[model samples]
Target chain A: MNIKNSNIIVLVSSILLVVGFIISIVNTMVLVSPTEHIEGSWKEISWEYEKTESGNTNKKISDAIKTEICKELIIHEAEVWNFLAGGNLELTSNTNNETLSWTMKGRGNILELSHKTNKIEHYNIQILNNDKMVLYFSTDIQAKGIVKMTFEKIKEDSYAQKI
Target chain B: MLRKFSNSRTLKDNIQLGALSAFSAGMVNVTSLIIFFAFTSNVTGHYAILAEEISKGNWYQASVVFAWIFMFFIGNFISNIIIINFNHKNAYAAHSAPLIIEIICLLAVGYYGHFYYRETLSETEIMVGTMLFAMGIQNGLTASISNFSVKTTHLTGLTTDVGILTAMFTKKKYRQNKQLRSKFNVLLAIAAAYLAGGIVAGVIYYEAKFLVFFAVSAVIGFIILYEYYKLKVTKYIRIKRTIKLRKGILETT
Candidate 1:
C-alpha cells in the first residue's frame, strides 16, 4: 500500500478508537446507573476472603465465624438474590427467605442492603455487569481481610417458557 | 537486525526478531494473567470485553477496557513514530528505542509489583495497562522493522497466516514457493517460541512471582545485545581484512 493510504487507514482506525472510548465514558456517565443494572435475579457462584496479615496475603475463607456466615448467607441450595424495583431486595434459599431494602450509594460503587431488623450492610461493587456481579467488603473478625462474593445473573429463558 | 529499513532485513533477522519478541510477549501475557487476571499482550479479548461491556450498559467497565485498548494503541503509535522519524539517521538507535522503553516498563512493573503492589484493583488496572503498552511497543517495532512481516505481541494474526500458508502448501506450486515457506517458518517459530515462553514464565512465576518480568526484560535485552554483538563482529572482520590487504600492498611496494 502507498504511504498516503496507510496513513489514512491508521488515522481512521485511531479516530474510531478514540470515538469509541469517548462514547463508552459518556454512556457510563449519562446512560446507565448501577441501580438499574443491579435489579435482577442473581445466583451466588462463589465467595472467598482475601486475608492480609503482616504483608503476606492469601485468599481463602478460613475463619470459623466467616465460614459460618458464608454457610448462613450463601451455601444453601439455590441461593439467589432478586433485586426488585422500588428499592427492595429478596433473598431466597432452601432454608431461609428475607426481604431487604437495597440502594446504590457512592456513584454506584457501594451497594447498601438494609435488613429487616435495621442492620445495614455495605458491599463495595467490585464488578457489576449484566451477567455477573462481584461484591467485596472488608472484615476484622479474625484478621484484616476482604470478603469477595461473585454472582452470576440467572437468565430466564422466555422462549423456553413459551415452549 | 540493526538495519531498520525493512527491505534490507534478512530472513535470519526476521526470525530472531519474531522469536524473541513473541517469547517475551507470551511471558508478559501469561504473567499478567496470573497476577492480574487480565491478558496484557493481546487486545482481541479486551476488544470483545469492551463490546460486551458496552452492550450490557456496564459503562464503567467499558471505559476501563477502552482505556486499556487506547494505551495499547498509543504504545504502537509511539513506537512507529520513533522508527519513522529516526530510522533514517540511525537504524539501530531508532529500533532499539522501543525495546528500551518496553524494558523500562517491564522493570517498573516488576519492581512495583514485587515491593509495593497491594493487589488492589487500581494497582491491577495500572499494571495491566503498562504491560499492554509494553507489548504494543514490541508488536509495533517487530511489524514495522520486518516490513510488517513479523508481529509478535499477538498470535491471532500469526496463527491465521500460518493456517493459510499451511493450506496453500497442499498445492505443489505453493510447496516450491520460497517466500511462502519462509513466511510459514517465521510464523511457526514465533508461535512455538510464544508457547515455550509462556510455559517457562508459568513455572518461574510459581517460584519467583513478579520477578518473571525481569526474565522477560532480559530476553528483549538479549535481542538488542545480540544484534550489537553481530555488528561489532562483522566490523572487526572487515577491519582485519582491510589491514591484511594493506600489509600485502606494503610488502609488494
Candidate 2:
C-alpha cells in the first residue's frame, strides 16, 4: 500500500476503534444499573395467576386469595428470614431444590450473595418489611419468572412461625 | 495510481490481523449479551437470551431472539463470502473491497436494524453486533492492504503493544517517526473510539431503539469512504510531484 492508502487504512481503523469504544462505554453506563446491596436474609415470594378460560375464579377472587395468602404467609416470614440469613443452616423441608446454596458475604440491608457452585450470578439482598426481605438477582429474568421466598426480621428471642 | 508505492504481503498475514479484531469482537459481543440481552458480533449473546427466556417461560421472545441471532450469523457468513469471492485480484483492490463491503453492510444493517426492523431487534443487540462486525471487517481490510502492519480494530492487544512502545520510547533508545506516530494515533484512536462507542450506545439505547446502530453505521460508512477518498488524494499528490520533478530535470538539461 502507498502512503496515501496507508493513511486511509489508519483512518478507517481509527473510525472502527472509535465506534467500538463508544459502544463499550454505552453498555457500561446505560444498559446496566449497578446491582443493589442489602443485609440479612429476607423473605421473597412471587406468584402468578393466569386467567384460565375454564376456571370460574375472577379477578376479585384472585386478588382476595392473593391478599389472604400474603396474610397467612406473614407468620413464617421471620423464621424463613432467619434460616436464609443464618450461616450453616440446612433445610430438610425445602423440597423445591431451587434454593441457591452459596456462601454469602456483606452486612445488614446490603447483602452480596454469591455461590461458587452456581456459575450464574450474584444476588442483591433487600429488606422489604419487618418479616420480608427481597433478593434481587442479576437480571430481571429472576424477578419475572420464579417465585422468590425470603423472610423479614420480627423480634429478638422468640422466632416467628415457620411456613 | 498503481506505482505510488509497493508493499507486498500474503493473505495469511491479513487473516492474522483480522483474527485479532474478530476474536475481540467475539468477546465483546458475548459480554454485551451477558450484560444486556444483545448480541455482539458473537452469537453467544443470543443464545444466552434464548436460555434466559426458556427459564423465564417466554417462548415467543426466545424464538425471536433466536431468529435474530441466526440472521447475525448469516450476515457474517455472507460477508466472509463477499470478502473472499468479490475481492480485488490486486493487493490494494483486495483490501479495499472488503473494507468497502464492511462499511456498506454496517450502514445497511444499522439503518434496517434501527428504522425498518426496529421491533425485530433490540437497541443493545444491534449496537453490539454492528460495532463488533464493523471492527472485524475493518481489521480484515486493513490487514489485507498493509500486510498486517496495522491493526486498529481491537485495543486489548494494541494496548499491550502501546505499553511496550511507551517503554521503548521512555528508554530513548529507538527513534520514533511518522510510522510510530501513525501507530500511536491508531492506538489512541481505538481506545477513544471504543470508549466513545460504549457511551454513545448507552445513551441511544435509553432514548430510543435502533438509533444507536443507525448512528454507528453512518460513522462506519463515512470512515470507509473517507479512507478511499484520502487514498485518491494521495495518488494525485504523488503524480503532481512526479510531474514537477520531470519538468525540473528537463529544464536543467
Candidate 3:
C-alpha cells in the first residue's frame, strides 16, 4: 500500500472515531432536539384551546369544535401522524389518508408541514420527547385562539388512543 | 476568477473570486434553508445543534448531526487534499476539481429533489449533509488558493473583518492605505454578492423550486469556462509573440 494513502486513511479513521466517541458520550448525558423526537408514529391525544379571552379550561373540547378547528387544517381530529425519515409525514384517519412533508424551523422549535395541495402550516413545538409531543398553533377559522394539539408516540401500528 | 493561484493572485482576482463564490454560497444556503430548513455554508449552528442533540441523550439525532458535521469536515479535507497533492502537478486542475465536485453535488440534490423527493426526514438529512459538504469544499478551496485572504462561504468572519476595516477607515491614515482599501473592497464585494445571491435565490426559488440548483450550477460552470477561455487566449498571444521574435531575429541575421 502507498504510504501516503495509508497515512491519510489513518487520519480519516481517527477523526471519525473521535467524533463518534464524543457523540456517544454526550448521548449518555442526553439533550435531544425536537426534530429527532418528532419522528416516528404519533397518535393525536387531544385538541383544546390553549388561550381564550375568558380563561383557561381543562374541560374537554366538543366534537363539533374539533371538526370546526380541523376544517381549515389538513389533519382530522383522530389521525395517526406517522412522521417517517426524510420529511415524509403520513397522516391516517378514519375517513382520510393524507401524505405531507415536514421540516423543522426556528432551530427545531417550529414544525412546518407542506401539503400536496401546496398548503403550508406552522406549529410551535411546545414539548417534545420520546413518547409525547405538544403542538400549539393559532387558528382564525372561527374567531382567534391558540389551539393546543397533543400526540403520543405509538409503539406498534395500532392506534389504541386517539382524539 | 480562478486563473491564478496562491501569492500571485491580485486583489482584482480575489474580489472577482470572492463575489462570484459568495453569490453561489448565498444561493446555496438560502435554497437549503427553503428546501431542508438548514444553513449549509457554516458549521457553527450545526455544532450547537449537535451538542443539543447529544446533551438530550437522543442518540439518533445526535448521530445525524454528528454525521452532518463530519461531512462538512470531510469536504474541507478532500478539497485541501486535492489542492496540495495536485497543486504542483497543475494548479488550475487542483483548484477547479473541488468546484467540479461541488457542482456535481448540487446537481444531484437538485435532480433528486425535483424528480424523486417524497419529502422524508432521511432525505432532508442527507441532502443537507451533502450541501454542507459541498459548501465545505468550496470554503476550503477558496481559502487555500487565496492564501486565506479571501473566504466567501460564511459571514461571521467576513462581517467581523468588515467591521474592523470600517472602524480602521475612521482614521484618515488607515483610509489612505492601499492594501487596507483593497482588502476592504474584496470583503465588501463578498458581502454584497452573498446578499444579492440570497435575494435572487429566495425570489426565484418560489418560481423555480429545485431548478434553482441547476441555475447555481450554471453560475459555477461559467466561472470555470471563463478562466479556461482566458488561459487559452493568453497562451495564443504568447505563442504569437515568440514566433514574431524568432522571425525578427532571422531577418537581422
Q: Residues A1-163, candidate 3: write the lDDT tens digits.
A: 9999999999999777776856644653365546667778988898878886545465356778788988788665546898887778898878878888888763455688888888898888767887889999887655467888898889763544532
- Encode model 2's per-residue lDDT on B1-253: one tens digit a residue: 1111116543333333333333334334433433344444534445665687558643334444544544454444444555566455443454455556655655565466546642212343455445555555565444434544555444557678788777767644444455565556555555555555566556655575544444554554444455467678988999999999999999999
Roughly what TM-score does model 3 have, to 2 decimal places?
0.78
lDDT of 1 by residue, A43-130 (tens): 8887677545534455666546565565434222336888897778888876888788876643355677676677767777878877
- Best model per DockQ: 3
The lDDT per prediction is: 0.81, 0.45, 0.83
* Candidate 3: regions farther than 4 A off: A1-110, A114-116, A124-126, A136-163
Docking class for candidate 1 = incorrect
Computed on C-alphas against the true complex, the DockQ of each candidate is: 0.13, 0.03, 0.19
TM-score of each: 0.69, 0.42, 0.78
> What is the per-residue lDDT of model 3 for residues B1-253, given as tens digits with 9 covering 90 to 100?
6767888999989998889999999999998887777789888888898788568765656676777777787888899999989888877888889999999999999999999986555577778888989999999989988989888886999899999999999999999999999999999999999999999999989999999999899988887888888889999999999999999999999
Error of 1 at B11 (Å): 1.4
Backbone clash count for every predicted candidate, in the order shown = 0, 39, 18
User: Which candidate would rank higher by DockQ, 1 or 2?
Assistant: 1
For residues B11-114, write the lDDT of model 1, one tens digit per residue. 88888889988999999998987666678999998889778777876666677678788889889989999999998898889999999999999999999999
